[model samples]
Target: MLSVQLFHNFNKYARITEADFGLIEQVLSKKFVKKRRTLLSEGDKSRYIYFVEKGALRSFTVDKDGVEHVIQLAIEEHWIADLYSFVTKAAGNINIEAIEDSEVWLLPHHELELLYEQIPALERYFRQLFQRAYVSLQQRLNLTVSSNAEDRYRQLLQDFPQIAARIPLIYIASFLGITPESLSRIRKQLFQ
Candidate 1:
């Protein structure tokens, strides 16, 4: 059975009538991922977009130095994907993995294309998702370039309040482009 939350999320972007939504429910498959399991590895073809049904997942990249940079943290109701690879049919540089045991709904790209034509409203939902993802990318770029580490950390807390407690501190530090020790100091300063 499909989740009501997913249905609500879909309707949030575009209306899907009861009958039309059944078309969607038919195509999405569910997968349960264990903690630390990789969903999409770097250099793999991005074949699917996942909607988090329960628990957490993260998308990140490993640098030449072997340092990981967290790109996005996805929790319940969040959609995670390497859109660039998905759209271009190119190999993806991003890696996605479960941070905790998780249940996710998968929407395969090939199926999505057929759904777009069959359910025109689905296109608008995906379009808004991509637009939001792009805006988030642009905003993060602007914030990273113009802000200090402390400011960046502060903004992160403000934007994703659940992240600090739900995700590991190390990943948060990586996302902020700072050492874990630096994050500890920032937390101390903010709290005390």
Candidate 2:
């Protein structure tokens, strides 16, 4: 059942044969994370890349003031990992936590390398995925630097309407680089 989302995502990039899917399944392990559980913590090495099959997860960092800044949110069918740590096996700066009780498929680095070696197409598939991720990150950074908090909030709503309904306002505010009170004000102004 979890493979359904994985297969659907992979199909967008490459034709995944049933045999390919079976081989891919062999390398994946399923894990359930409870809400608010930390899957990866700051200064810990990220050994696995997670694919969300159900529920939500987020990556964030706390500032010196101890304020949390959300970096990314991954819901169903999305992938989340500290890419630098995953690639270099270094301690990560971000923390990944489950925002809700979740089911995830984990692909270990070693198993991923083996799959890449055995199935060359898998390498290309991941490269495309990374390229897209890079572009999205760049676009997000652009928005963060150029847009006002209210505009950013609007874009967030336009992009992920489901998020507002599912996630708390505090988290959404942090993701927008605004205070929760500011978000409340903005929503009031927009709605009223």
Candidate 3:
């Protein structure tokens, strides 16, 4: 299952041979996490980048007032990691937790480097992944600055309808940078 999704994700950026797929698979380790389990905590060093095979995970940060801000959400076939920590071996400021019972495949930093050397095309694949992530982040920043709260919630619904169905509304509200009551009012207006 994970192999199929992994190969699909890799092939999106580059052509991968069976041998290449096998090589990539060899470096991956599978993990299952229950809902609410924390995979990576704030201030912890990130050791592995995870690819979701099933369920959902969220990355977030807690502010001084203890308000949690959702930064990213990864579902099936998506990748999740504290990229800063994973790349620099520094403490991560974000925490990643399972929003549902999840199955994931992890690639350790060492093995990822080895795989890049062994399978050079993998480097291109990863580069493409980073590029897309950067673009997404930029788009999110633009949306946050330019869009109204209702428009933001609508855009989120248009872009990731599955998120509304899969995660709690409070988390979705946090991700949209709006209060739950505000989101409720927006939803009522939209539906009415």
Candidate 4:
């Protein structure tokens, strides 16, 4: 079931042999998470980088006041992880949770290191993936700093087309760094 997409995703970054891909398939484990499931809780050292195959997930942090500030959102075909914890083996500050019932492909970081040596192309593929993730994070930070709330909201919709419909507005407000009431106002204004 996950065959074509996984293989296609790897080949999109680098030409991979079937034998090499078979190794990757062996290490990957799939699971279905119900909505609101927490894949990685805050303070946990992450062992896997999850690839969303069906639904959506988000990474966020809760403030002292119990309010969540979303850091990243990953939809189908996208990857999500607490990179710092995954790479350094330290506890992570952010929590990764499912927004919808999601089918995810879990790629173990421990196996990935071995895969890199066995298949040189895999290293290139992962390197490219990390670079792109970094670039996206930087761009989001830049947008948050430079753009107004409405512009940020608009950008979110443009970046993730189904976000406004599939994701809760409160999560959207948190992602945009705005209050729920303010987001409601913005939506009202946008339609007028």
Off by over 4 Å in 3: none
Worst 10 residues of 1 by lDDT: 16-25
Task: Return model 1's CA RMSD, one decimal.
Answer: 1.0
What would you estimate as the lDDT of candidate 1?
0.92
Alpha-carbon TM-score of each model against the true structure? 0.97, 0.95, 0.96, 0.94
| Best-fitting candidate, scored by lDDT | 1
Clashes of 3: 0
Candidate 1 steric clashes:
0
lDDT of 3 by residue, 1-192 (tens): 346878888889988888888888887899999999999999999999999989999999999999999999889889999999999999999999999999999999989999899888999999999999999999889999999999998888898888777888888889989999999999999999
| Residue-wise C-alpha lDDT for candidate 4, range 43-86, written one tens digit per residue | 99999999888898999999999989998888877889999999
Q: What is the lDDT of residue 2 in candidate 2?
A: 43
| Cα lDDT over the full model 2 | 0.90
51-78 per-residue lDDT for model 1 (tens digits) = 9989999999999999899999999999
Which candidate, 1 or 2, would have the higher lDDT against the true structure? 1
Residue ranges of candidate 1 with Cα displaced over 4 Å = none
